[model samples]
Target: MTSLPEDPSPMLNEADRDTAVQRLQQAYAEGHIPHEDLDERLHQILTARTRADLVSPLASFPEEEDAGTAFTIAAAGGRIKRQGAWRVPRTLKVESAYARVHLDLSRAVIEHPVIDIELQLGTGKAKITAPRDAIVDFEDLHTGWKDTLYKPPRRSVSGGPTIRISGTMGYGRLKIRHARR
Candidate 1:
């Protein structure tokens, strides 16, 4: 006999309900959902009591769907660190003010053929780094800075992975550094 994955419906909570509704609204505005359907689904989601109930209506948006192929990490006035295995799509977005955003792509997979980064800050900064044994592809690169610093170095690792970042930065600095294994 084979074991099946456990259902996640029991994990749904009040907070999840709120988040799901917000995402649904955003999807509607982004044209991911039609107005009539949005109205019907939003009502159901608001009254949903389980994870399965909440997620059933969201099937139209794949869990891995990258609406804009963009992943965002933002800190308004503090520091934020995101590590572990992650999926990188076509675009990455970071926005902060007096804060920092760091992406440690030591065990991440870059699936997009062309990766782009777009960052905006009021008085904050952003950083994206990869592990030593990673492989990166940077054929299409675009970065912008406004009243801030943007620093990315060029180097190679003997047995480390590579991270290719192509994006924009506004009003802040972006520093790309290497992670020590």
Candidate 2:
């Protein structure tokens, strides 16, 4: 009787290992792989003994280089442009350590049709601005300061949209401004 060959490919080259892992994670996030199966496969890949062991499954997805960035935007059905009416999902989350993010939506139309503008921060500061009518909702605002003159300015327009700002700040400030009608 003849013995069949075992599957190989999980044993990828050192340079390609990280890329493979990232691709797997992306696939999992995209719902291409089932959760249970992904977990099992990931375990196998991590314990892979040789490059040949990693070739089979890795071939299922397209090969690509890894782009290093902590924050990732998965805008499936939204129009992101330089100038125009901008309509994004109400829930916006800025997580982890972000040194600074300046958003200027002066020329864009912002409608608060969603629930709230969520901003979750770990470290650093973020500055966001929109039309005066835009609603700003901050769930948790934490400024890690004992006593200082610098305080996040909060403003709202009369008979206009509302602005909500909520998040934790570590010695940082949040400023909100509305367009003059």
Candidate 3:
């Protein structure tokens, strides 16, 4: 094995990388960093070499509360849509009774390896477009009338995050699809 003389710091293991990623997500959840910052830091965390190199990626966030943040989006009678470089929280709860909800993550910045979305909807359609390599799970979802429309990817992407969905839909359709590469 070859070693660099200028840097003798120990290399990072998978566990170290995972921890750093968690810290980054927590920071974003607490509003310490924006979506763009999270994207950059996520790339840095995933590509860092040594433990010392992890500093800059996990630098900004301080523990404000005991837990990370969860977002709740509620709508009444119109359409709820999010797309184009939006921020995705670690946990999201979408509530609606008569609104068309659309969440497009194909161009969003997602740093965490897992995101949970809970939906409570009635009489409105919901559509979600995930990243090209993401894995979406609707196993915990229950629909009142129509079934959810989701087709799994033909091949899985290694290291891709999992999007878990759990909720109750009433007389509305839930559509989940992946982005084109």
Best by lDDT: 3
Q: Which sections of candidate 2 miss by over 4 Å?
A: 1-85, 134-139, 146-159
Candidate 2, which ten residues in sequence have the lowest lDDT sum?
A: 74-83
**Whole-model lDDT, candidate 2?**
0.50
> Model 3: residues >4 Å from true position, as ranges?
1-68
lDDT tens digits by residue: candidate 2, 12-49: 45555565566678767655677877877776667666
Steric collisions counted per model: 16, 27, 0
Show model 1 residue runs off by greater than 4 Å. 1-69, 131-172
Ranking by TM-score: 3, 1, 2
lDDT by residue (1-181, candidate 3, tens digit) is 1111344359887877786787788678657899989898999989998977877887767543323568999988799899999888888999988999999988998867888999999888999998879888899999999999996667776656799999999998999998876
Higher-TM-score candidate among 2 and 3? 3
Candidate 3, TM-score vs. the true structure?
0.65
What overall lDDT, based on C-alpha atoms, would model 1 receive against the true structure? 0.61
Q: What is the C-alpha RMSD of each candidate to the true structure, in Å?
A: 14.1, 14.2, 10.4
Query: Which prediction has more favorable TM-score, 1 or 2?
Result: 1
lDDT of each: 0.61, 0.50, 0.83
Give the higher-lDDT candidate: 1 or 2: 1
